[model samples]
Target: MLKHSDIWRAIDRLAHRHGLSASGLAKRGGLDPTTFNKSKRMTPDGKLRWPSTESIAKVLEATGSSFTDFVAMTGEEGDGTGGGAGMSAAAMRRVPVIGYAQAGNDGYFDDAGYPAGNGWDELEFPHVADDHAYALEVSGDSMEPVYRDGDIIIVSPAASVRRGDRVVVRTRDGEVMAKQLARQTANRLELVSLNRSHPDRSLPMADVAWIARIMWASQ
Candidate 1:
């Protein structure tokens, strides 16, 4: 069962883990800065205030944290490092990440390098330049242990996506996927999954939408 104190404690730890203040975390989650403030944690009558489920969900999305992790944050951690102003502004200017499964879909990313629409589920990360940036979420168990479902991956568009690099690719018909780049012959690219349970696949160069080297993951 969820309790008010547990929720507040989790919020505090989350801010610390991300090196953000309560207000900074709230801003990254697309909420009003006061949403996670100490004063907001109580009512005018002095009753303990609980964070709303929607707010919690947004915070989780923004921080790339799971429900289990949030629960584990109940124990107090030390005060997080400061520089909230700089980091918050830097975060706002950085490239955004989205679920990996959505990359190849035509409407998900635009030619201008901006993620299409405001519909993306986002994660807060240290600033990354726009040209070398992209975000993808892990899907399925094919890359398990190394990458898990729901892990947000950061891709460097400026980095050369060569053979042997882990990459995010799109199929001609609009399927997005992540796998290790294998062979790159004249007309095709081969990809392999980390999990041996899945067979390797070869795809024609013409069938790909975009290819970029994966830089890091939140997992």
Candidate 2:
């Protein structure tokens, strides 16, 4: 039996293989840009919203992928011998992890928010599904209750972030912070601290280096 997750995984893999985001793939296929977005994968009532055959066919044609390739990506090819064993393993990737202290240090990360130089530790985080995924280890109690010391958070620069999403933001002045997104606009961003001890902050968007959504956290 084909699972809804299986189909979506195939789409995600297809997009990644082509170096395109789900929306980008959709756009390339002449479909609405949000057709394959994560938010559209499920209905408002929490039911799975399976992609239509027409959309799938269009995307396959756009990317020059065949239906057979899509099936193999779903991990349903072969003689059903390996089953889903390889799927889980293939989904995971070694993510570079750095302590919050080291994150603020120079040369630890590049301009695009990717780990650049050395001193990074590796952690086997379960499928972030984003090429720009990285981990940050919390070191202080500034974000306690929600995120305590030693907690590892997986961030995805490729993920779409909205209000209420936990985010990691770095400023051009060298300030890096993890906070809940309160608001965002053309000129500024407002962030709220999980810990009441720290006051909410508002910064000019121009001063922000990069802002990535916190995808997952290891408590």
Candidate 3:
């Protein structure tokens, strides 16, 4: 059962996960810094003032947080670390993990890009509301500087894709790559290479099999 306290606590957890204060999270969402301040949670008469849905929407969008993540942040309150924020143990799960090289193989993912075949490694990770979330191990210099070899990135196919977000894309020919999304048109997608040594790509939508947003990464 949801309660008023749960909602406020969720907001705090969200801010904590992002290594921000209530005021900082508000600023990041383009709201007044005091929007989530403790004082704002109550009226001058001492009545409870719930957070607006619009505010929640903006913060989620700004943080690139899936609704599932926000929902997971609700329910409990415990001491969370500052700056190096992490989810509670109960919110962690073992997700399918695959190497970047193996990710392009046909037997690994379904047509929609969800993990399918066996032989995948498992990694304990933060709660991603989408059950289809998986991890990919990096292995090359193409995504250097930002994502070096040996790093792991979590991908969420259920999350919304937008310009400026990092993403993993699989082409019809079975080529898989990660890049920052720069632009998207009715027929084309423009991706910015993580490494300057690698040229950016502009691909027709017809060539794309599937694309998923990078929700979390172990840097």
Candidate 4:
């Protein structure tokens, strides 16, 4: 009988074949860059967490592989080449992808375009506006208890980041991070870190790359 670990191992092999780590494979698939990160493969309690079919399909597409190839990769003998019951390779392929550091930023990304970087991991996500997808990496413990270092944040580029919404933004100097938007107006943006250890920060609109509202995190 097939096991969850078996499927995980197959995905690991697929990543290795592409000269990438498991996390890298997820990036290639347009999922959250941390989707395949070892830290995320298990729960905080230390139990294994299986990759969703949506994530698998996304990985296949990002790597330019087919459903049949994925099935072969899974090593599930006699299981038809079509995707399993959870997700279809075709549907997962169509979702947008983004890099971790690039999440939450706005102007820097375009719906019809891709972020500039090779470091990313894949994730399964619902279909959204072409312009509304991206990812970001946790830089500090500012969002602690909720988001930690190395956590990947998925943001919807098209979604409006309102006050209290966790958003990603980059300064003109390229300091990118995820913070809750406390206030926004024509002139400035005020942000509060989820972690009380870090003080709130504010910046002018001109200093930002682009801001996107965060939708989910791999925590």
Per-model TM values vs. the true structure: 0.60, 0.59, 0.60, 0.56
The digit string of per-residue lDDT tens for model 2 on 161-214 reads 999999999988778899999999999999999899999999999999989999
* Candidate no. 4 TM-score: 0.56
Worst 10 residues of 1 by lDDT: 77-86
lDDT of each: 0.69, 0.79, 0.80, 0.64
Model 4 segments more than 4 A misplaced: 1-21, 24-84, 93-114, 117-119
Give lDDT tens digits, candidate 4, residues 56-168: 88888876777666556666432233335434444432233444445445544444334544344544443445443655545545678887555556666667567789877
Lowest summed lDDT window (length 10), candidate 2: 78-87
lDDT of 3 by residue, 1-219 (tens): 877788878887776565454655676788986787777889999999989999999999977887777776665544333323455577877677677888988888898889997655456666678899988877678998997655678899989999999999999999999999999888999999989999999999999999999998754
Q: How much is the lDDT of residue 68 in candidate 4?
A: 64
The per-prediction tally of clashing pairs is 3, 0, 0, 19
- For model 3, the run of ten residues with the poorest summed lDDT: 77-86
Candidate 3, residue 174: how far the Cα is off, in Å: 0.6
Which stretches in model 2 have alpha-carbon errors above 4 Å?
Answer: 1-87
Model 1 bad stretches (over 4 Å): 1-93, 111-114
lDDT of 1: 0.69
Clashes in model 1: which pairs? 99-137, 100-136, 100-137
Judge candidate 1 at residue 144 and give its lDDT.
Answer: 83
